[model samples]
Target chain A: MKETLLPSSIKNKEKRSAVHAKLKQQKKVEKKRNQKVREAAEKKALELGEDPPPKKTPRTIENTRELDETVCKPDDEELFAGNDADEFSSILKQECIPKILITTSRFHSSRGPDFIEDLRSIIPNAHYYKRGTYDLKKIVEYAKKKDFTSVIVVHTNRREPDALLIIGIPNGPTAHFKLSKLVLRKDIKNHGNPTSHQPELVLNNFTTRLGHRVGRLIQSLFPQDPHFNGRRVVTFHNQRDFVFFRHHRYIFETKESKTPEGKDKKENKAARPGKVVARLQECGPRFTLKLTSLQNGTFDTQGGEYEWVHKPEMDTSRRRFFL
Target chain B: MPRTTTVESPGCPPLRALTFDSLGLVKVIEAHDGQDGGAVKMVERWGDPDSSKCVLAASILDRESDPLVSVARKCGSIEVISAINGDLRAQIPNHGDEDDAITGLHLFSKQQSESSSRACKLFTCTTKGHARMESIELGGTVAEFVRDPSPTVWDVCGSGNILCSKIDGNENYALFGGKGVEVNLWDLQKCVKIWTAKCPPKNTLGIFTPTWFTSATFLSKDDHRKFVAGTNSHQVRLYDISAQRRPVISVDFRETPIKAVCEDIDGNTIYIGNGSGDLASIDMRTGKLLGCFIGKCSGGIKSIARHPQLPVIASCGLDSYLRIWDIQSRQLLSAVFLKQHLTSVVFDSHFRKEVPVPEVTNTVEEAEVIETPAKRKKGFKDEHTSKKKKSKRSSKKRLSDDED
Candidate 1:
């Protein structure tokens, strides 16, 4: 057996254990004294018919630590709870026409005039505003006066139209997108006639981290409340993280009348009379957007590295839309 | 140790203001005049010197009469100490729960009766959205507790949602901000909420929410119904309870979140401080950035207090330095290292005569001497000796100024 070198080792276990026992006894005595003092205070308070003073909780250093952790966790269900899909979809019944005002930066290249003309062909209701005093407040004021639902601001950097900032009227959920490819309607010669139907909006494969931001930006670009007179129906769908966008016309039509059977006649007699029913009809001029890449905080459609996957087949009635 | 030796030999000016920091130390500093850096003397130090209980908020009560400094600690204990002697007058334990740190301390006077004198009421709010009002009699008896109902919306956030505010003249109104909740004006007299301005929805896509307000102040004496808030979103928002529910004015100031905000005496200018140590003055009417005050503040500023009758503002924060800046010139006048992270500062506005005028010639000579490297090396030793003599002479002069 090895000899214990230290004085406070197991060789002197009895002494060490005795010291520990002494400490334990002292602690017990202290605790009892504290309890007695507290009881005495409480009894005195009771005699006086007053509440005893609240006990002082011991101070801890953790109290000074920063408490905010809600900003990082976006998946918190409570934050997403109030977003009612029905309430949002109800906007389609209110605003159908998408009247847009196009305003480019004052310091743009010669290509700006030609681009504006091309945009007018694609969006017939779009109006061009000569950029003069490019202040956000002034621009918003002008757009309000013109009664435009959305204001599209084309920002130029180094003589290149590199970004598009879209702000909805009245109150904003503003969206900024990167402009790329610069393809005009005339450049795609094989493309069908412009007057054949309404432009189809196709938003494709915007699913990555950067893609989600772009997708949300595009979604907010549309007005929160739709104009029913415009007969516009905007669709946003995501499948396996690939978001898709389409804009089409929708009209409400009265369903055809049919003679009631014996069981239906009994139910009809019990129910209130004269309820008008309408069915939704989807129409033409669809726009398609294929989001290929994101650069400089904007959606870029020209990047060729985008991985194209076959569109998933599903019943339209059974499919759920993301936005 | 002799009291005079400990108190007087440091050659610092007399104390005109008191502040408490997160280290649980209370320091009494001399107030600065409008020109530049003034003398800061730690005349009396109190509380747990080892910093066992971090001081969260502090306010000086009855500055015009019986001056008392009330400090709220992180452990939910509130201690009132004398401003002159640092004697503990009253200690209330468990004023709030341990998990809920006190966020603000406001002192207001309320008339108790027709025959009795006015009593000082201390209103405190905790991170847990608990608000309590306690009436303290002249004899240091603390009683008459009034607590507001816990805001149900903030229940899930717990201590993450902190509330801070300033009390109105009669202690009848409190304007406070809650994280991700709303800015609410409460009627403390009736213990009811008056109105609420909901926080704007964040613009981020499913992540990176905007920060809540860290500090706020009423716009001015003329418009008590409106207030300005410095938010973690790096924006200054002005809300008028009389107007619409949304903010009346919103302007982005900087990239870093704003930590402190105060309105100027005229109410047309707003002073703001950010977490990155940038202090700026903004024109409230035009919404234009006036200028930034350059200082040696490496850490975030926690509190900003302007002089009652001067163009100077004093600020203290994590850098452990109390800095005085001239709002007109945008120059740092003085910086005093207190060796503790300061959380709150309150000026003794009643002690008006204690302010010291800036010594222009002395600073100009020092600047010139620093420019010449050859002369600086030779004058370094002489400068130290002269500085000590000047400090002694200035201390005597400061005493005379106080007499005036």
Candidate 2:
């Protein structure tokens, strides 16, 4: 202290000058530029009738002098790698068994003949028989004629977790569905060709979801009417939408280009399901399923694809022998 | 959630907190499909039972200790029924477990199966209406009870013998009622009797289309032998069952004429629920108004009964709500809205095991869930026609036996 740097301030100034002499003058010019920017911002705020001030930031202590990428890299990369591997496995191994359907009563409303049109509201792909029906039934006959293992009623119901049935087979994936509480009054008894074979699955969980659905359906018939309990379920949502009646199941591919041409000009239209949509799983309490080897696009209408089957007993996928 | 309701489990999700204006005593609830569907409302019929989820029309869910079994009132009469007919369920818990883990020890083992032929005889009443005093199995399959063609044989009342047929057990005693009063005793063998005193009436018959008396009971104190018919009107008549042709009490309700009456429990108490959801409890001794409960219901009040263990009065209405009221506290204990209409109410307190009976609120779901053990087909098989012949031999005998 006695030998005191002849005025520590003078000594510090000399040190700064020596360091500054080697550096370019741009550092000083940059500082002036930053000051100008700050002034301009403050001036703008004042003009706008606002208050502007420098913000205070809390200081944080730095623990380590340097980062070690090796410490965090391996586990994180492995986690990401694992995720990618799972996604690949799930996608490739995914397969689904046939679906189980629970058909409700088909009695038309007392309102009369026009009620058939109402049927379309509930049955997405209703097959009419004059031209469509006879053939459909014939197909069922063909299945039974071939002595297929069993028949299946394909439909939907509401039960959580399995909101949609047939999520997937032991390794296969199933179709997707969106379910509503409304009950549908559909008579599907005469649709399939006369087949004598019993169905692969008989769904008994019909009453719960069907009652809910029918309750909804009955309510729909008389919108303003109260339910059997004198209570009405009324909840509105922005995205609530009903399925578009798919009167024809033939528009396998061309349907994807439905949006206006310009909405997404760059969209790659090639990947659509045109008969092979990547469906999401939905309601599934009454679902029954079986494994078959038929590829996408064409499905057995009667749910009888005998040629494609898995014989767990034989531990093999054996093709059905057609006479 | 709307299947069956009790104190611990209220059937319906709470309605919108902003309650709406209700009409009369009954209020209706309606809901449409998602955002764009229709609605269905329950209608209340006065006097007759509401058959929605008609398990009991019998009685609404109560605070009784039993599980899945409800005791509903037929006017003042009590009868019991299981909430889930396990014989009708595929995954019946009481049907026992399917231990599929035999593993390496028993490699070729098959799932063992059992027949429910005997269990089918548990949950039904053989006789439907007035009956001639004949010995019959009381609570069993509905199929075993034969509907007697004789006019006075139960359910055939309108067809014939209301006097000789209406009685409990195969005893030679008969129970009848009067106008605004209670039940009377008559002898099945002797045809008529004399009673001691008269009690008050409680309900009307809606489905049977008769003056189905209410609050009628035979006290063990000597049976209807000690009690007499009550008449609240001038046109009313009374009979002394213990004696012959003696009138104990004659009463009337209207100046014109009151026909019959009945009592609930043992004539000590009686309950009467009206169309407007009004339930009145009366003290049988003096016919005094013990208490009255007023609540809004959408269906007609068909039947009502007191909780066997709780201070609740259960009522069934055409509105599909099996409602329980805390008569002492004058509060609504609970309401179970059914998807189906109710036609009758009987109370039975037999303990039913705990089981997840499927949805009663869903008409479809209920039917679907009960697909288990459904009736066998009456038709034939296409394959192995020879086997069909064998099946025919057995199945034909079954239909005639009517064991199903």
Candidate 3:
């Protein structure tokens, strides 16, 4: 006999309502921001003592695209290999993280989706730009508002990229990248200036293949078959949303957040303590293969792809080790 | 341990295509399917001693479940690729450790200079009329696309470089000769200017198309590159790669023109297929016909491939038969007939099963794609003008867009 886990429908509905309301509020904010821009232009004109030109009404077609696009909304926890749990919590309280964007070139002869399938293991809360169609301008817009921890770019071939990996968590505004560009090292305080304890990792001689020409005309072995396509989807996928989450007993990393409107409040719930970076992108390269207990969840596109309130529980390191 | 072995099964799907590389069997590709250009399956058999044969993948879609017509294929040392993903992959039985799949199929393609950003890949051709190539460094995904605009761009050169042969599907040739007389030196991808030279002409007593017998190689002792172009002209022309120099030695043989020239017994002795279908042994250092063991055959000898480890020479000709001839004794050890009349032949070390060629029948879809007999008569008037348009290689615009 297998255990059948059922989610609380009331909680889900509440989360959905909050998200929808937030979206509407964001739209109103955008309209106000546009008026501010208009006012700012008029104030400058008044300072110069010159009459401003008449504002023209924008023309539009009825059948136009309807979607929000913003470039940098950082996710909840931005971890660039930082070990300080306290520092991350304090950063979250200040509320300033930027979303990450990872874009690469597409080859002339092939099409496939790989990185989108394997990202759950790395980042806790992340989503990809799956808008059915590809639009760079629109993608960039989403990246602006997306909360991201870090952006990692990789390539399968030499000249150009075969894929892109982006992880967007929340801890932004400023990161340890500005502190020292090091991994898991700290700063030493002294009477005057404090010397850093962890030196920045050796990053010299590191080359990234981002924007390069890729296709059969350039490569001697140009006539490549596609990586993945419709047939592949039919063979492998259980659903459009093949989302899985795993909790490893040995390693703990989680992002914590509170329910909005002051409901079901708990004392340390809002604090993202000991939580690892939540990633929006899944299906990527693996650094090391570790055993973990994974759980699967059903996610429908009926709601928006980004559900902020559906934030995962906080993750912490193991308290005790037997071996 | 018997590291390498070649089996001859008479009842196997009459071998359609065969290609051989240095390590032995490149690929024995088989194509089957009648509906929708006939579905295809490919299996990779290996000849390397340590590693076992590894199964590649299968890509086939048959509506009627019948075999297909003749399909061209390419084979190489590292990888094997074809225009149609057929059922030829079933022949390669799986074995060995995970990493020890098949040897890299495109091993022949070497980097000339770092000037270009992309890595140059090489492929091998089997006697089964199949061409195969494998990705070298950028290895994850490798697939070729057949453009409707540039339809007949399929072609393979002496260098294992796969390119478009006929621009608009005519006989736009870059390599042709009587027993491969003139070895055409072509920078096919760059200049596209074909440099032809008079080497050896096929002397198979005036029968069949002439094939080239040149195998371009490098001289390790001097770090120099050269080519040994064999001709049915009873001569072998050696060209130095440094200067695209003239022939170093045009070795004329005794009594027969060179039809087939291949490496034998450590690259010292060259196996020569003479004009009279005679197999001769010659010393590489001094081009001397040491022995003319086998006297004659019914068909003109066109192709010859040496065994990877054994002193064996596999030969084929217009007779539609492949014979594995021994160098020591002029005896026919094993022989097999091909499914169709072959254009060329090579022994692939990766050949596993002699899969039976399934019977191919016309499908309703193929009938619809092609014009009916009554309409085909009227089509000629319009076809004459269309033929000229179809023949031009530079015309890449789709017919739909070009109608404007």
- Measured by TM-score, the strongest candidate is 1
Per-candidate total of colliding backbone pairs: 26, 118, 107
Candidate 1 local lDDT, B1-404, one digit each (tens): 11122111112122266677756778877643332324555555665453446788888764443467788887788877666556666666874356877887876655545563434566778786777776654433334322223322212123447656777644567777757656778777677777877656656665655447677888775566878887776888888888877788888976666878878888778889876567899887777899988653545677888776667788887556777777788777656666556788877655533223258756655454333211211222344454654343433343343233
Off by over 4 Å in 1: A1-323, B1-15, B31-38, B140-160, B201-211, B352-404
Between the candidate structures 1 and 2, which one is better when assessed by TM-score? 1
Range of the 10 consecutive residues with the lowest summed lDDT in candidate 2 chain A: A240-249
Q: Name the best candidate (by lDDT).
A: 1
DockQ of 3: 0.00
CA lDDT, every model vs. true structure: 0.58, 0.30, 0.33
Question: Model 3, B1-404: lDDT tens per residue?
Answer: 21133222212221234533212223344432332232222244333311112112111111111111111222211232321222221111122223322211222223445663123333323321133332233211233211122212222334322211111011122222222234444342442535555433445795543443423222121222444555433556565545554566667664444545565535456666644355666665666767764422433455566655444566764333456555776555445443122233443332222223333533442343232211111122333444655452222232222223
Name the runs in model 3 displaced over 4 angstroms: A1-323, B1-224, B241-246, B254-257, B293-296, B350-404
Quote the positional error of residue B2 for candidate 1 in Å. 41
lDDT of 3 at A73: 24
Q: Which stretches of candidate 2 lie over 4 Å from their true place?
A: A1-323, B1-130, B136-172, B177-184, B188-267, B352-404
Candidate 3 local Cα displacement, residue B236, angstroms: 2.2
